[model samples]
Every structure is written in C-alpha cells, then in structure tokens.
Target: MSSLELCYPQLLNWSCRGLECLHSEAVLLYTLFSSIAVITVALNLLVIISISHFRHLQTPPNLLLLALAISDLLVGLLVMPVESMRIIESCWLLGDIMCSLSFFLSFTLTSASVGIIVLISIDRIVAINYPLQYINVCVCRVCVCVCVCWGCSFLYNGLILKDNFSLRDRHCNGECIVVNNYVSEAVDIVVTFIGPCSVIIVLYTRVFTVVVSQTHSMNSHITAGTGCKVKATKSQRKAAGILGIVILVYLFTFCPYYYPSLAGENNLQVLGIVTWLLYLNSCLNQLMYVFLYPWFKKAIKFIATLKILEQNSSHANML
Candidate 1:
C-alpha cells in the first residue's frame, strides 16, 4: 500500500484515540483553564468599571488603559469560554462560521490591543519630550489613534476571513488555520507580526531616547538650581527603571507568541500560552499604572473611597 493510504488510516486511529483522551481529561483542563479565565475576566472587567466609574481616571493615558481593558475583557468573555469548551470537547463543534468569527475577533482585538500599547508609549514619550506642547497636541489624538488602530485591525483580519471563509470545514479543528492558502498565511505573517512589531519597536526606541534625554536635562537643572542633584538623579533612575520593566514585559510576553507564528508553524499549545500571557498584559497595566504612576494610584484610591462611602450611605438609608 502507498504511504498516503497507510498514513491515512493511522491518522484516523490516532485521532480517535486522542478523542478518547480528550474526553477523559476534558473536565480537568476545563476546570483549571476556566478558573484562570474567570479570574482574568473579572480583573479586566473591574479595570474597565473602575476607570469608567471614576472621573479622575479619565486622563488621556487612562483612556487608553480603559480601551485595553475593554478589549481584554472581550477576549476573556467571548473567546475564552469557547476556547475552554473546545479544550473539553477536543473538536470544533461551533461550525466554520463561528470558527471564522472567533478567529477574526481574536486577531483583530489582539492586534488593536498591541497597537494601543504602542500608542501609549508614544503618548508618554511625546508628553515627556514636549511637556509644554502636551495639552495642545495630546487632546482627542489618542481617541483618533485608537479608532484608526481598531479600524485597520478589523480590516486586516476581515480580509483574511473573506478569503478563507469558504475553505474552512465546520467539522475540522476549532482553531483558525488557513489550510490551503499560502498567500493568506503570508499576509498573516506580514500584517500581524512584522507590521505591528516594527511600529512597537520604533515607538519604544524613540520613547527611551526621549526619556533619557529628559532625565539628563532634569539632572542638569537640579544641579544648577536646587543643589539636589542626588535626589534628581535618583528620580530619573526610578522613572527609567519603570519604563524598562514595562518594555521588557511587553517584549517577553508578546514576541514569543507572534514571532513563532511568523515562522509558519501554528503550534496551538504555544499560541494558547502566549495568548494567556497577553491577556495577563491587560491586567498588568492596572498594576503598572497604579504603582508606577502616582496619578493613577491617586485615582484608584479616590475611587475606592467613593465606593466605600456609597456603600455606607446605602446601608444607612436602608436602616
């Protein structure tokens, strides 16, 4: 018999055996991942709510944070549930339409989220570099940039769906894979990986340069005026340290996920872990903003106090 024929039957047998294993372990993995997913969902949702409910949190950067929270919450709410079910079932039961929709939303939201991070870096750099010009140039610009990022992301992923929707088999795997379209695969590589990654790298590079320059200027000013060069230097170092951590986390979590996909192998396991880590990024932003930036911390504390007061008032009214 030919190798193709020999492999076909073996593939079927292995698939069947895999299905049996999937059934046995489904509940365990589902419980574990579902728990993580639930926590992630709650965290992102809380971020959105906290930011929205608090007026002080409505700064330009916090606005961007709110957008990130929304995207991450959608990922946790819409995508993760289906993903958990798929893990339990070990098969794509939602049909090709849902499969396509899921992939499209996941890709678009993820891309937009990364794009927003890049925008946030740029916003910070500009604010630091041209502090006097910040108000003039910064207002309404972040919103416009966010809209453009989301629109382009949807357009890019929509094209992928348009081209490959008919070819997908409802009975096949739940994951999005362009089975026969090498061109679609190539587009995914360029647009998804190379495009946003290049922008992120360049933006952060500029941001680092601007921050270092500002720190040097501040050090010089403090030395000449306040005679507290030591304190100024320490502050500069602290700012730089925080920015470095943010950049490192972004690269570590996101690069591993997309770089591998660019190389043409869709290792779903790696992809899943990376996706989970990326979702973790949204949650991490709350920590970063609150701890690394004083303004955000103040805003959060104020919101918490307000909530506490509201609860007390409600109890008194009930009494």
Candidate 2:
C-alpha cells in the first residue's frame, strides 16, 4: 500500500462497495473536473493565439503576458488532460514514466507562471517609479529576466523528478502530490509558494507607494498647470490597479491548492477542487487583460477590425 492508501483506506475499501456506487461517485467528480479543465484550456489557447498573432499586442509587458499565457496553455493542454483522464479512469493507468513526466511538466509550468507574474509586478513597479529609466533599459533586459525565470523553474522541477516517480502506488493519479521527504516539501513550499508570494508582496508594496507618491506630485503639478504630470499619474495608477488584481487572482487561485498540499493531507476531493480553480486562473488571465487593461482591449479590437478588412479585400479580389 502507498502513503495515500495508509492515509485514506476508505478509497480502497473492498467490503462496503458496489461498482455502481464507485462509478457514480467517480463520474460525478470526473464530469465536474473535466468540464472545467477543458473550458480553461480552450480559453488559454485563445489568449495565446490572439497575443501571438497580433504585433500590436507584443510590447515588453505583453511579452510577459505571452509567456504566462503559453505556460498556462501547457498546463491546460498537457497537465489537465492527464488529470481529467485519471479522474475518469479512477486510477493512474499511464504507469510511472508518464506520471513523472506529467507531474514535473505541470509543476514547472505552474511555478514559471507565478514567477512571470512576479516579474510583471516588478516591471510595472519600475515603469511607474522610474519611467525614464524604464524606457532606456529596452526589451533585452526583459528577455533576460524571462529566460532566468524559465531556467530557475525548470531546474527546480528537475531536482524533484526523482521523488515524483518514487511513489510505490500504481493507483495514484496524475496530479502533483507532495513527496514524503522533508527536503522535497521544503523546496516545494519555497519554490511554488513562499518565494513567489514574497516577490509579489514586496513588488506590489513598492508599486503602491510609488503610485501614491506620483499621484501627490501630479496633483501639485496640476495645481501649477502641468497637464503631462496628470496624465502620467493616471497611467501609473492604472498600472498599479492592474497589478493589484493580478496579485489577488494569484493568491485566491494558487494559495488554497499549495497550502493544503503542503500540510500533507490526502483529501482528494479538496485537492481536486483547488486544482480545478488553479487551472481556471489561466482562463481568468485573458479576462483580466480584457477588463483591466485598456490597451489590450484596443489592440484586440484593432486586430479584429483589420481581420475584417482583409476578408473584405479578399472577397473583392475574388469577385
């Protein structure tokens, strides 16, 4: 028996169960998880394609957005499908090899997504607090930072791949479970939760402070008839607001999942729900960009308009 069987013996109870009883419960949970995962994947793919195909949406900050979208898209397309299939099969039929691969890929992408968000918060902080400096630094620094995030997350996940595959249970599903080792648990907490959350808190704190300071400065300048200062202040506040929302979404979607997993509980039902919500975060990113950022909305609209015009021109040529 594996650690899960030791913890939750009821899951494998051979005495008080029928096939119907097991099938009904499994189907209900599978439907709920699979539907949500599929929708989340679809939405993330849409966001990735939209951003990738549109040159107008390819700024430095939006480059971070593209990275995030791609990471989440992988989680949806690769990780969630395996998870959903596991839920339906009621066992990890893919055996140990695919299990380790899936678990490592899922955790790496999830960590990288969080890291990218932290980088975005830092970028906004710099942009708001040091506008002239930001313009001078150029896109090369952004690329380097993104590459660092990817490399760090990849290495972190690679370190734990052995523990991920060491489980003795063939019935364990494809979802990421905490390894039964102190070092692995500690690393998971630091890499997946603590480090990212620390970055978020620090960067957002500085960002809010800068925004407040700029707002006050702009108000004073406005009193002296400086229109540019007012515009600058408004832009700073808008960026700050968007960052705040991103932080909230990250906390709400991710913390619940990591918190319980780190606690070493084997509550599969709770784990399933938290995992689904975390996947939903990928879909929510697009919605956040559409609702919070005016530039994103305008760029999307512009792309739509151009697409329409191109279609019309093609129709005219055919005629």
Candidate 3:
C-alpha cells in the first residue's frame, strides 16, 4: 500500500488508515466545515451579544436563548474543528487524554444545548399560555435553571465516560472512542434524546395550540386603532412558530447520531457521519435565528458597525 493511504506512514502497520478522498473532495469538505464553524460562532455570538448587552432584551425567554447560544457557540468554536479533523484524517492523531477531553466536551455541549432548547420550549409555553403570570418567571430564576442544566451536563457526561479516563483502555494508538457500557449508553440515549425530545415536542405542540387560540381571540377583538395588544399576540405566535421549527430541525439533525443506540449497533463509520450532522445543527441553529428574528439582523448590523461599542448603546430599541 502507498504511504499516502496511512494516516501516519512512518508508523507503518500500526498507523490508522487514512480517509480516501480526492483533492476536490478534500477541499470541498474542508471549506464546508470551516465555513459552517465560522458562521456558527459568528451568528451565535450575535445572539449572545444582542441579548446580553441590551438591557431590555434580557427577558426570561431570551435568557434561555442566550444560554443556548453560548453552548452552540462553543460547539462551533471547540467541537466542530476537532470532529472535522477526525473525519478528514480518519484517525485520532491526538493522544488518549486529548481524545477523552474531546469526547467529554462534545457530550457536555450537546446535552446542554438540548436541555436549553427544552427550557426555551417551556418558557414559550408559559409566556403564551399564562401571560399574566409570565412576569413571575423572573430572569434570576431562568439563570439558576440554566446553571443547573450546565452543571448536570458536565457531571452526567463525566460519570458516563469515567472509564475513558484510563488511557490503557484505549483500543489503539490512533483511535478515539468513548466507551460506555451497554446499560449506560442505553440510559444516555433515553435521557438525552428520548426524554428531552418528547418534552420539547409536547411543549411546542401545546404552545402552538395556545398561540392559535390567542391569534383567533385577537382577530375577534381587533378594532380601529386598538390593535396594539393584538400585535403583541401575533409576535408571540410568530416566536412560537419559529422555535417550533428550531426544535424540529434539532431533532432531524440529532436523530441520526442516536441511530447506533436505536439499532443496538455501534458502527464507527456511521457514528462519524451522524455526529458531524449533529454538530452541523449548531450552525443551522443561528441561521434560523437570522431568518426568523429581525432583532438578530438589527443586532448583527449594530455589532458589525461598532455601534455596540458606544456608551448607552445597550439602550437602543432593538425591538
């Protein structure tokens, strides 16, 4: 075999096999992943800034979004590049410790992202369904919940992949894999995917139902120059609709990643494609924000033009 066919030719038989890609394919994949990662970071950063810097934009729902953006931003910043290299090289060039760290980071971020989405769904439901008491859901409470989600994610992944910390357990010199026992993997899939996704879907469905009813109520009450409250209702409905789309897209991208757990087979090749597909969801998430939220676009303009750097800029009416 040619030296080029091995990830590290000098290691001879011990080297992991390299991915066979033509020059065009390599360029395309590199460009694609790099572009996605950059876009994901930039877009999510816009969200974080828009919500965090603007005092009025720091509502309970937006706080949840801020947390979600933070996780997504980390995905673009940390996980995508490593995963892309792992795919392109078809080998783990990083040592066992780095590999363990990579898996831990990836799992924690993905779990926290999903948890934040669930929180967002619940927030929307409460806002639309119980508008009078929505004020009761204060920013501090939301912040606490976000903290708990992140903490749990870190602890959960650490416990699940505890065995990976032992470098001697690694199967080969050029392979990076997280080994969870069958019971743990099963529980992880159910808790991470099945349970959270079910709650997300159910909450979104109820939120949409309430939104439709509110829309109809507003339509029946619309009168000459008294449509101000009605307009707010429409905005709420639109937010719900956009977030529903976000949840659907999240599920679509993530379903493949859990296919191994679903089929009860752990195939490395299949896991590679699906895990990247999962990471791509982070990139797509910010794009959804761009298309759905005018505030995001406005914030991007402000951020890009150095307007945000000005004193009292946080008071700008982004709504």
Candidate 4:
C-alpha cells in the first residue's frame, strides 16, 4: 500500500490506516460537515442576537431559547469542526488530552441542549395553561433554571467521562473513542434520553390538550372583538403545533443515537449517521424558528441590512 494511505508513514506499525485526508471522499465529507457547522453557527447566532438585541423579544421563553442557542452555538463553533476533522482524518492527531477534552466538551454541550429542550417543553405547558401568569413571569427564575441545567450537564458529562481522562485505557495512539460499559451506557440512556424524553412527551401532551380546549372555547364564544381573541388564539395554537413538530423532529434525530446503548454495543458503525443526525438538530431548531416565527424573520432582516447597528436598535418592535 502507498505510504500516503497511512496516517503516519514513518510510524506505520502503530498508526491507523485510512485513505489520504485530502482524498475525494474525505474532502466531500469535510465540505459537507463544514457547511453544516457553518450553518449551525450562523442560525443559532441569529437566535442569540435576536433574543439579546430586541427588548420586546426578551421574554422568559426566549431566554430559554437564548440558552439553547448558546449551547448549540458552542457545538457548531467548537465541536463540529473538531468532529469533522476526526471524520476526515480517521485518526486522533491532536494528542491524548485533546481527545479527552474534545469528547467531554461535545458530550457536555449535547447534554445541555437536551436539558434545555425539556425546559422548553415545560415552558410551553405554562404558556398554554397559564397564559396570564406566563406573560407576567420573571426571566430571573428562568435564568436560574438555565443555570442549573448547564451546571448539571457539566457534572453529568464529567461523571460519564471520568475514566477517559486517564491515558491507560487508550487502545491506540491514533484512535480516539469513548467507551462506556453496559451499565454506564444504561445510566446515560435513562438520565439523558429516557427521563428527559418522558417529561417532554408528557408536557407536550398536556400542552396540546389545553390548546385543543382553548380552541373549542374560543369557537363557541362568538362576540364583538371575538376575532381579536381568535387572533391571539391562532398564534398560540400555531406555536404549540410548531413546537410539537420540533420535539418530534428532535426525537427522530436523537432516537438512533441511543440505539447502540440500548442494544449494548459500543462499536459505532452507526456513528457517522447518528452522530451527525444529532448535530443536525442544532441547526434544525433555528430553521424551524425561521419558518414559523415572523419575529425571527424580521430579526434576520434587521440583522442582514445592518439596521441592527442603528441607535437604540434593541427597542425596535419585533412584534
């Protein structure tokens, strides 16, 4: 075989074997992943700026979104590029410490995203069932919850990857992989996937039920300015429906990611597809927002035209 096919030709005996990193297939994958990373950064950055810039948009729910966007942004900015390089190279060229830190960072950010999804679900329940109270809600409490969510994510991933920090378990100098025993994998599924997902499913179920009831109530009480109430009701219903779809899409992407754990297999033959599927969700969330939320559309317009740089732009009416 050609020396070009080896990761390190001089150290061929220990180096991992793979096609050249600049090969057509590798370049194509890198391009695709790089595009994904860029889109994820751009979209989530918009969300961050929109929520932070517009005073009218600084609601508690949007705060949650800001938190989610921050997590996703980190994934796109820090995690995706590294993972793409790993895929293109098929070798761990960054050394042992980076291999450990990079995977830990990825896991932490992914876990935070999941936690925020659950919080979003809970937020929707309040928005639908207690609309009056939800509008008057304080962002500080939501900030606390977001903090706890991130803190827990850091703690959780640390525990999960505790063994990885030590170099004793590394199978090869050129390979970077995180291996969890059957029990650890089971625990991860329960904590990150099963538990949070169950809460999301139940919370969304209640949200939909309330939305249905509100729709029926509004339909029956026809009066002057009834259309006004209907207008508000329509937005709520649309938001609830869109959020449901977002949750469904999230489940679709995340389900296969846990398949290896559920099946008790460590080998990630499914890694390339499932890992990126999970990555895709980070970008998908912003896409859904762009599709459904006019505020986001307006935000994009203001941002793209550099209208955001004008004086007192945060006071601009997004609604």
Could you list the CA RMSD of all candidates, in the order they appear? 6.4, 6.0, 2.6, 2.2
Candidate 3 segments exceeding 4 Å error: 1-24, 167-170, 217-229, 265-267
lDDT of 2 by residue, 1-319 (tens): 1122222245554212211225667678777777766766765665665656655555688788878888887887788877776434434545567867877887788889988998898889878877888888666877899999999989988887676666735333333344546778777878778888998989999999988987887666566568777887787888888899999998999888887767776777688678777877877887787787665555555455775246333222110
Model 2 Cα shift for residue 304 (angstroms): 5.7
Q: Rank by lDDT, descending? A: 4, 3, 2, 1
lDDT value for model 3: 0.86
Residue pairs with backbone overlap in model 3: none
What would the TM-scores of all predictions be?
Answer: 0.77, 0.81, 0.90, 0.92
Cα deviation of 21 in candidate 4 (Å)? Answer: 5.9
Deviation of model 1 at 283, angstroms: 3.8
What is the TM-score (0 to 1) of candidate 2?
A: 0.81
The positional error of residue 290 in candidate 1, measured at the CA in angstroms, is 5.2
Model 2, residue 41: C-alpha shift (Å):
3.3
lDDT of each model, Cα atoms only?
Answer: 0.65, 0.72, 0.86, 0.87
Q: Local error of candidate 4 at 249, Å? A: 1.5
Residue lDDT tens for model 4, 1-319: 1244556667767667654545777778888999999999999999999999999999888899899999999999999999888766766788878888998999999999999999999988888788888878898999999999999999999988888887524465677888667678778999989998899999888888888888899989878878888898887788789879988988998999988767865564478678889988999999899988889999999999999999999999998
**Candidate with better TM-score, 1 vs 2:** 2
Q: Pick the candidate with the highest TM-score.
A: 4
Per-residue lDDT value at 265 in model 3:
68
TM-score of 3: 0.90
